[model samples]
Target: MAKTFKYIILGGGVSAGYAAREFAKQGVKPGELAIISKEAVAPYERPALSKAYLFPECKFVMLLCLLSILGFFISVEFSIKIKISACLARLLNIFTLMSQLDFAAPARLPGFHVCVGSGGERLLPEWYTEKGIELILSTEIVKVDLAAKSLISAGGETFSYQILIVATGSTVIRLTDFGVEGADAKNIFYLREVDDADKLYEAIKAKKNGKAVVVGGGYIGLELSAVLKLNNIDVTMVYPEPWCMPRLFTAGIAEFYEEYYKNKGVNIIKGTVAVGFTSNSDGEVKEVKLKDGRVLEADIVVVGVGGRPQTALVKGQVEEEKGGIKTDAFFKTNLSDVYAVGDVATFPLKLYGELRRVEHVDHSRKSAEQAVKAIKAAEEGRTVEEYDYLPYFYSRSFDLSWQFYGDNVGDTVLFGDNNPASSKPKFGTYWIKDGKVVGVFLEGGTPEENQAIAKVAKVQPPVADVDQLAKEGLSFASKI
Candidate 1:
């Protein structure tokens, strides 16, 4: 029999998680909503895979705690001793605080996944059952019949829905996609999901004190480089761009990071890319050949070139634009009862008066919530306001972090002290378009300061003097 749902969410990710919460808040009846995911586990904060999840000491502690709880039937005294040991290790800075524990064993159904980094309650499997929401995990939807308002799974099961929300997220682009030689060599990895993270983590552990070649200078590359370096792995980063994160980072901003990475014993190889890879007898990557005629020995290679939207499943079935599914301010597609959100949806950016596809986590959460709210309102014969989203992107590497708001178009004015050796080093960039500050980037900003920059980007106050704006820096955003 074909199961039916009042609302069906495709792709279990941050967007899907937030959408489920919104639907419940809107009084979705039990059994009316369901989430179909290809992953075996429920949605989690994906960003953690790159940040906290890669910490060796943290992973070790988690494994130990899980084994103790699941097997051996440890006594209460032993449990207390374990707790005290964890507390002492933390106090002595032995390992990253086990504060954000996820997926501890014995009771593995729900574990430490949810409200990542926010100290929020973990949403375990019981949470879904208690809410009467069907979690169709480990299922791939092979076909979608928009006219029939139904989708067929790979397992030959049919799912009918009154409304469908597409949130298929994205897939990591691999070197094989680019026809790089020996791309399938072992120890060559990419990080996009939990399994990917686990593979990379295990490789890092196996190749301790090894030489790592990181391809691409984007967030993943930068972050993984730092992670590898912290684990005492010698890292060399290769990218085709003149600087890192060219999409959002100006040369001035890149200068600081390049210097910082260099200080951390990382080799920055810019203006080139890995053309091929050579492997050992065991079919493991041993060397990386660069386009500029350089060969470097490597124990492991991590590639983070980029990713494309997972829109192929519905590409021709829906209106497409800007390399993603096209939607309006409210995330409504051209087809009725069909909506798209997150990285898959290139919706109108009212703030910029243009269409954009944001792949950041904040947008994923907000867009999903907006879509659900709009759907709920329409169901009640009411209408909701259009989604007005300001562009926001952020990243963390080592002890440094940054946040950017608005478009990175037009001329950029760099300011603040960006010297790598300076104490209390803080800096920012302003994207000026037509004598107005349209974008803001700040590193090491306090919560209040970040909000101030966001407001400046939203209002886009005029700046008559570029040099003055640079000189004033964060103060200019504060005044605005």
Candidate 2:
């Protein structure tokens, strides 16, 4: 017999959690919605994996207690006092509480995850049960019939739905995908899910004081470099780009991080990539061969090249653009009663006037909420406005963090103190298009300052004097 649902969310992730919450708010009755996920647990906030989850001191109870106190203070004093929002305030509180308790210890299965970084309470397995929201965990859907509005599981179970939300998210890109020989050698890792993080953490412990080669210059590469280094491993980073984070950082900004990493005892090998791997008799990676014909010994290799959308299930069944499932402002696909969100959805950027696929956590949460609101409104014979999103991306490593908003197109103006040796160490960049500030990036931004930059990017006010704008720097954003 085929089970049926009025609503079905196809992935367990940040988007799925938010969608579930929105559905509940919209009065989804018992048995009306089901969330099918391959993960053993419900959705959780994924960003913590690369950040606080890898901290070495996270294992100490005293340190965790201190972190909890600190997190609580910050959540109540800063987050709540700023009137951020009830949801954001709760998220901040939970983040701090969990960081001290859950993340302070080595992440245990089903124990350390935080659900919905913002908004409501963490959705535990019991929460789903109490809400009567079916959670089909650890189940893989083998096939989908879009026209028939049904999906088939690997175990021969059939599920039908009146509406489908494709929140499949993304899959990590493996080195083997690029034809790197011996890429599957043991101790070579890629981080995406909880399992991957656990494996990497275990490998680091097993191979302490060993050599590590991180292949990639993006967020994953940079973050893992710090993580491995913190684990007392000798770290070397390799990337084809001349500078790290080339997609976002200008050469000037890259110079600061490059120097900072070098100061932290990290060997940066830019303008090259790993082409092959040498393994021992145990099928364990021992060395990495570079494109320049150089071999470097490696006890472990971590690749963070990037990820591709997990859209293989619907690639041909639905229209795709920009390497993802295509959607409109409401996150609706061309097919009726079908939609997409999170990393898999390439929707129109109403703010930028083009279609874009954002892979950040913020967009994942916002898009899912938007889609649910639109769906519920339609069901109630009402209409919701189209999504108007301002692009945002952020990353954190070591003692530094940054945030970016809006499109990174057109000319750029670097400003503020970029010197890695500076005491305060605040810097920013502005992307100008047609004499207007279209993008903003800031390192070491306070809450108010980050908001200012976001506002500047959103309004895209004119910048008549590029030189003056650079001179004003953070002041320009403040004044605006």
The models' CA-based lDDT, in order, is 0.86, 0.88
Using lDDT, give the best candidate's number. 2
> Which lDDT tens digits does candidate 1 get at residues 343-388?
9999989887789998988899899999999999988999998999
Off by over 4 Å in 2: 57-116
Query: Which clashing pairs does model 2 show?
Result: 58-104
Question: What's the CA RMSD of model 1 in angstroms?
Answer: 6.3
Q: Which residue pairs overlap in candidate 1's backbone?
A: 102-112, 103-112
lDDT of 1 at 392: 88
Any idea what lDDT model 2 has? 0.88
Worst 10 residues of 1 by lDDT: 102-111
Among the numbered candidates, top TM-score falls to: 2
